[model samples]
Structures are given as structure tokens and as C-alpha cells.
Target: MRSNLLPILTALGLLSLSQAFAPDPEPRWWKGNTHTHTLWSDGNALPEYAVTWYKDRGYHFLALTDHNILQESETWFPVATAGGARLQPDQVKAVLESKNPLLEERTREGQREVRLNRHTELVQRFSEPGKFLLVPGEEVTSSWRSPGPEGRGHPVHINAIGLEAFIPPARGTSVVDVLNQVFDAIAAQEKSQGSSVFGHLNHPNFGWGVSWEDMARIRAGIFFEVFNGHTGTADAGNENHPGTDEMWDRANILRLTELKLPLLRGISTDDTHHYHGGKVAGPGRGWIVVRAKSLDLDSLTQAMRAGDFYSSSGVDLQDLKVTPTSYSLQAKVREGEALTIEFVGARKGDAPEPVVFSTSQGAEASYTFQGDELFVRARVTSNLPHPAPKVEGETQRAWTQPVLPGR
Candidate 1:
């Protein structure tokens, strides 16, 4: 009877087809961090404490991408008065304060051990519908050593976001080979899961490990970290190496013009390790704001792959609109803060270096497409100093995804 009434209402034009079924919710910007660690791996803090930190700071989602491990197994940590069990005093304090019932107190031969909560438990404790989310992920950490007297090696770390199972690091002869292997594995997982899973290359310049040319040669990965908050990585390259931004531009130029692969999108991540003190690799340093219908895993990952996100160290974008004919941006700024928006891109000719097409002052800027450009992207810089600057003399900055001429 209800089905017949719906058809009769449609026939009488009381309800249009568009109105008969609910449309998707309007997409909104959700703040999230893709790479962070806890005691599930080498990080100093407990899993619940990390979630509490981000949630309290208004982060919509957090991915705990521990090194080659998922938070699915049972684990325990020693309650240390001194620094023992690879646990610091502050870490123990944070864990005990949470009062998680899963924590088992046992006298293990001499030391007191407390069972740690698994990822499932963490999800049940913190995740709220459309408010905060915990995404399960893994850092497929791998390395390769060059065959020489010095035996120098490179760290190849790739992050797999929104995965249900663990994936071991894929190996190969060279850096490019290893990267391609990891991307292939990620693809296989996506195919098998029938869900959108996100993957990105992490910190290309950490060990001066991946060169711009190496990045351009990869067959698959479409995302990489343009800015990582960790101080260990050389984000600003020296005389011999190029920075991550340089690598991004050069690799995109090669990929779009010559290699015939898709342009790479940039991401900013905290890569957090320490949660206490003025530690270098701490949280709240970098993140991405994704525009999606809701703050769920599927929506966030879908929006990210669609290039509907912006990465930031400190600058927050007020508005970003990209159409087939133009690119525009406006930043949300505080008083006494100055803004500079650089419209950067390359031309359609042979091996053109990325040049600033135009620059705008104040809080807003834009550029109309000339139809002769390979791609265009924006960079917003502000005078406000980063609370925890990744590099010396660094200020606040944000990067938008590159826009192709059309499609």
C-alpha cells in the first residue's frame, strides 16, 4: 500500500523523482591526520591517549599507521616507574589515567604488566557517528642498500590507509622497483576488498632516499607527502638534493608530458611519534582537510582520491574552488597575519620549469586557465610562525592539488 501511494504521489506530481529519494548530503571539510604511531609500534604513548589528543583538538579522523603491523592482536606493556619495557613514565601515566577495563594487572615474574587495548576496543571507546573516526592503517616500512663499500641504504616507507588486514613490505632491487611493488599490492587489496583504500608515499627526502627522477619513474602511486612534520626528514633539501616540492613539480611535469601517467597529488602528514614534551615528531604539526559528505572512512577516502582535499602545515583555507576554466583560493587568516597566494604551473611546451603565473596579496587569489598550461596549483603562505616549525625559519603554509586543463 505504501509503494502504491508513492507511485500515485509521483503520478500526481506531488513528489518529483529528484525529491522522492533523498539526495546525498553536501560535502563538508573534515580535518584528519594520515600518519601517526603509538605503542602498537615504536610510539611512546598508548593508543587511547593518542585518540584522546586528536579528538580533543577537533580532528575528525585519525589513522594510526604503525610500522608493518595492524592493531588486531593482544598486547601488553609494563607499568614502569623508570623507563623500562620500552615505555616511558609519561606513557604509563597516560595509560593508567584512561582507566581502560581491558588493562590487566599481572606480576610477570617481577615486573608489573598491563594489557593494552586493541584497535577494536579503541574504536568502541572513542568513535562517534559523523564526529570522530579511527582509521586502521599500516606503514609498509622497507629499505634497500646499495651494493658498494659504504653500503648506503634508503628508507622506503609507504602508508596503506583504511585496511582490515596486514600487508608485509614488498621488496625489489631498487627504490622505484620497491615503490611499484607496494602500489601493486595496494591495488590488489582495493580490488579484493571492493572498497576505496588510500595509499601514499611517505617522506621521500628522509634519507635523501628517493630522488625526483625516481619519483617520476614509478608506474603507480598517485599521492606523496609534500610536507611531513618530522624534523628528521630533510624537507628543505641541500645543495645536492631537491626538496619535496621540487620533486612534486618535476615529477608531475614528466608524468603528464612524457610518462603519460596521472599527475601526483600532494599530502601533508604529522608522522607523529612523541606525544609528550617539546619533542620534534609530535602531533598537531600537519594535516589534511578533506571535503566529503560525512566524516566516515569511505567518504573521506573517496574525497581524497577525487583530489578534493588540501594539505596544510598551519594555514587554513577559507575557500577553494576549481573549475575547468579557473583556479581560485581564499585563506582563513588571523589578525596581524599577512598572506601571499602564488599561482604556480608549467606550460605545454618541452620541459618547462614551473613558474609563478601570478601572485596575489591579502586573503584571496585566483587565476583563469589559459588553455596552454599543463597544470596549475596554488600555494598559500602566511607570516604566522609555525608552533612547532619543521625547519628553521619556517612559517605557515598550505598546498592545493594541481588542476589539469580539463578533467
Candidate 2:
């Protein structure tokens, strides 16, 4: 009924929201990092360091998602404990040596260090009109011990993007149990606050945690990390575990076929911790290009939930178009680099729906739906290697969002 009503509303020039699947006001792609960390958790740098790192590298937006913690209050952390007092020797050295303006030196309780700015304060300072933004978020690092040493268990991290409040990780014995609770908390927060929020399951292959079956059953888990930049978090699957790409296809197939759920959207992020060096799993390693009405947080999040974005690691999209049945895309190709655009999706009776529909060796590519397929999406691969490769032959790539039956 909702699908049938869209054409009527669009024709009558009434409110045509999702049925329209229309682009936002003056739509343009805004680049951002959705999963990230700072000194708030196990990250090695300050929150502002992460924020500025992305902004300087041409990102339009950012979400500082530290584990189970939001940057809400003023707190001082010891960087290099010495002289029996709190100290940030590395941060101080960097600040003084480089003379970065964002760094603030302060004396608190007879300890000298760089002052860590709260999320509220940094948002005010970093937000620029139509240029940069910081979307407040937190990573709910859930755990379910299933036989690891010291009771330390496999990790199930979910990032609640555009969150208005903090959500503690849901604890359970099964990964699916924890995932459902985390998603419910995100939903409940939006319900109570009268605001909007969207979240995605973090790297499935990280620590060899989360499987195709683990993600397939969670009706609320509509997004996951198809690509992550952190080297420790393996994106590719081995013989024993399903790689992120495999998990993505399998989960989508089971969800769309058996459960009749919504299509899962793919996202990428640096998951960066080290900020001082170029070789680290740092900012600019991965990002999402979101086509939205504006560069503000609200518009970006709205576009993201609607899958109006593509994940990329060092690949830039030149243009994209989608109808109910087909998708067209063009990638920005660098000189001396070869490009291959592959269309992938699931057909009837396939456990995983992704079968290659077309392969083009150029900057532009397109694919029309065969109509019998569950959904169709595209992946653009380039011969250009990453400036810092996570694994061997980890060339540059971009993932377009899936196009479903009516969208």
C-alpha cells in the first residue's frame, strides 16, 4: 500500500517522502567518518585531534565514537605518567613542536597537560557553515564470552551515529542477543528524545567476531561495516571465518528472502586510533560520500538512513543515479590507474544473492535489474593501491548502496 501510494502522491504534488525515493535539496556528496575513537577510550589521541584530522583531510562531517563513552564532560587523562603526576608528554611535545592551535596546555591539580575538550565545546568550535561538522555518537562495545581467556570475549561493537545520549552496550551470551538490545536502545533513545538516529554494526571480522548467521537474524541490524581501515580489524575473510563482503551478501540474502527485511546498507570508516603519523590506521583511510540537502548533521543522517551514500576507501564517485530497476555510477579515475565497475546482486535460490551482472573497465558503469533479482549494487575497483594498505593487494574501492525492488 505504501509503495502504491507513492506514485499518486508524487503525481498529485503532495508529500512524497520515501515513496518518492527522491534526492534531498540541492543534493551533493558530503564525506565523513562514522566509526572513530580518541583518548576517551583506547584511542591514542584527543577528541579534537580526531575531529581536526578529518576536517583537514577534506572530510565534510565526522562522528567521534569512543567505546561506551561520549565526550560530554571535561576530563583530564594522563598521556605519559611521570614525576608522580598526570602528564601528556607526547601530546605536549606534539603541541609545542608543531604549534597546533587546537592544542591547549593547562595546569589541573598540579598536573600539566593538553586539555581535552568536551563534545559540546568542540562542536561549537569545529562546525563551519557548509564546510565541516561533527555528529555526536558512541560505540557500544558489547561482549559475549564463549570461551576466551580471562573471560575476555569476542567483541560486538555497534556504533549509534547521531546519538543524543549515551547507551551502554547490551550484554548477553549470544552475539545476536547483544545486537538486538543495542539497536533497541538506539531506537528507544530516539523515541524518548523526539530526535532521529541511525546506527550500524561495526567490523564483523574484527577479532574474528560476528558471522553471516549472527547478523542475518537481527531485524533491526540494517547496516554493517563492509570495509574498515584499521589493520587489526580484518575486512577480508579467511578459510575459517566469513569475510565482511561475504557476510554482507549472505546476511542480505537470508534477510531479504526468509525474513523479508529491509536491504542492508554498507558503511566504511577509519576506526582510527593513531593520529600523529601518516602510516597508522588513521583518518582518510575510509569514509562515506553522502548526498544530502546540506552539510549539517541532520541532513547527513537523514540521507544515510535512506542509503543515499556510498562507502569508499581512497575512491571518489563522480556521479550516481538510481531508479526502481537500475543504477548508474561514475568513479573519479586517477591517471595511470585502471578501473573496473562490477554489478553484483542475488538471484532466486542463491544462498547469497550477489552474482555479477556486468563488469565495465572505465570510469562509468550501469546495470538494469533483471527483475527477478532480490536487489542490485555496484563495486568500483581500481588498480591504484592504498597509500597505506591494510592487506596485500588492498587496492582502492568504492561500494554503492543497494537498489531494491521499488527504490
Candidate 3:
């Protein structure tokens, strides 16, 4: 009996040693664009071509977030206006050439001319294992009244990532009601599928329509675009409503500290529609670099859910850490330009009223939270080209991972 017990104990000790020696999981960075359009809806480039554009540009992941459609079924348009919106002459030629083989087969059977791959098919074809990935997504394009009674509907775009199918736009009597409906739909999807499908209010300042009140009352909204790459979407500047970044901080301060709602974070995206003949069609204007355990969709979404990403127009951060005690960030700069980092936060008793603490620029910086501070967030900027520039004025801006209340 003693001999048998001794052998069992030795085996157990060996098992424990094996477990201890196993390697820790590796950390990875996945660069992704959450909002994008393709020929399936209003975008100018074909889905296949757009996929190539991102994959070729070193983007590890992309989402084809067309408006209100999932690129599932096949559709067609006239040869002259095959893909809606504007198309450069070369874009037209590239599309037609790619479809020439299919056209020849159709011609032999006395059928009509020209066809392109369905958006889903194109994405599936282009996506490869561990190299590049295409995650299914969509923008629930809706509208709201600006001011006047029966005010003209202003466009409001919302990106839904990791969705299984298309979500129809919420039809309602008011913008607030519409937003609530959309939010509810997203929540339902998350509950039913047990999948990570994050939804964000896109570009509140795009039309100067969405307000602090609008964001304050949103119950299910977890994120809103702090920056968007497109014409007329204001990320900076002090015009009435706060800049998207300021709005994020003020809203979080009020909601979490004052109103006791869950805190929300900022997201940056290239809400790209034009893909031909302009600066808007260019890529790398805005993106989010997410730190995840793996490059898969689940891991990426998990990180996003935890606010483990930074929005960027340019500027990459070397390290970012957020904890209950303090918030810190560091930026890696380009050769010629200097870098600056700012730690921004609001205390619980610091008056729901907004205030700017410091506006100095430097290579590195930190802010101490005093009194009843609700949470803290940071922004890092550099003299680099805007990663996604829809217009001339918007330039490079980098935002750090948000550190929320109650750790």
C-alpha cells in the first residue's frame, strides 16, 4: 500500500510541474476598421477590391459595414451605374475587367453582360486564416429632426460589429425613440446569439444633431465614435457642443458619477463611403488598435468590450495602462515630430459642469485624480498626417484606452 501511494503522489507532482511550465498566452495587436462601405450599398468600390485595399495596406482585420445591408444576397445595377455613388474611370475598368470571364461565359449562352461577386462572397474569398480577416458588420443608417417642427431628417450612422445578419433601421416618431429602438435591437442580438456584437453611435457631431442630452439618456449604448474619417464629421474644434472627445468625458462624468449609469468609451472609425477620386477614398485615416489575446473575432470583441483599444488618426502608443489607483499612457512619435500625452478625468464632486484641466503638449504626461473623481481618459497627439482624412483640416490625433469608474 505504501509503495502504491508513493507512485500516485509522484505522478501528481509531475502533473503540477507540467502545468507550471506551460507557456503563457501571447499578446497580439489587431488593426481594424469598424465602419466601411462597399458596392453592395452606397460605396463606390466593389467588395473584393475594397477587401484587397485593406488587406494590402497591412490591416489585419476589416468590417464591411454597409448601410442596412449585410451583402448576403446577389444584386445588380446598370452597366453605366453598376455600383451606386461615384466611380473613377479606372475603378469602372477594374470592375469590368474582373467580371470579363463571367461575361464571356454569359455571352456564349446569349445572356446579358457584366456581373460582380456578391459582397459576402467577395469577403469570404479574400479572407484567409491568421493573415487577414473580414468580420461581418453593418451601419444602421437612420435620421433625426434637427430643430424645427417636422425638421428635416439628419443622417445618423451607427456601426454594428460581429453581427450575424442585417438589422433594419429603427422607424420611430423621434430620434431619441429611434436610437432607443436600435439600441434595444442590438441588445437583443447580443443576448440571443451569445456573440460579441458591439454597437456605437457614429459621429454625433457629423451634422451637429446628437447632443449631450441625447448621449446621457442612452441606456444600452456602450460606445460612440469620438472620431470619424469623412467629410463634415467634426472631431475637434469648439463650436457650441463639445468636440467628440470632450463630449465623451463630460458625458461619462455626468452619467457615471452624477446619474449612475454605466460609463461608455470612445471609438474611432473611417466612415468611408467614397472610394474613388478624392482624399475621402483614401485609407488609414482613422482606426483602432486593439490589444487582444488572439487575433480571432471573439478575442478582438472581448477586448473592445473591456475598452482595451485606442482610437487613432495617426500616432501609435508604446504602452497604455489603466487601473483604479492611476491612469497612464505613452506615445511613440515619428522621427521629426514631438509627441504629447494628456491624462483627463472628472471627479464625482467636480461638478457635472465641464472644465479643462491642462492643455500643455509634451512627450509624456500624467494627471492625478483628486477628490471624488468618477473616471479618467486620455488623448495623445503628434505632428503626423491624419491617418484617415476626409477633408483638409482634420489632422493627426490619438486617443488612449479609457479608464472607467469603480476600476
Q: Pick the candidate with the highest TM-score.
A: 1
What ranking of all candidate models by lDDT puts the best one first? Answer: 1, 2, 3
Cα TM-score per model: 0.93, 0.87, 0.84
Consecutive 10-residue window with the lowest summed lDDT within model 1: 95-104
Better of 1 and 3 by TM-score: 1
Tell me how far the alpha carbon of residue 234 in candidate 2 is from the true structure, in angstroms, after superposition: 1.4
Runs in model 1 with CA error above 4 Å? 1-22, 83-86, 99-102
How many backbone clashes does every candidate have?
A: 0, 4, 5
lDDT of 1 at 212: 81
Residue 293 of model 2, lDDT score: 85
Q: List the candidate 2 regions with Cα displacement exceeding 4 Å.
A: 1-24, 79-90, 93-104, 108-110, 147-152, 278-280, 350-353
Residue 171, model 2, lDDT: 78
Error of model 1, residue 73, in angstroms? 1.4
Error of model 2, residue 105, in angstroms: 3.7
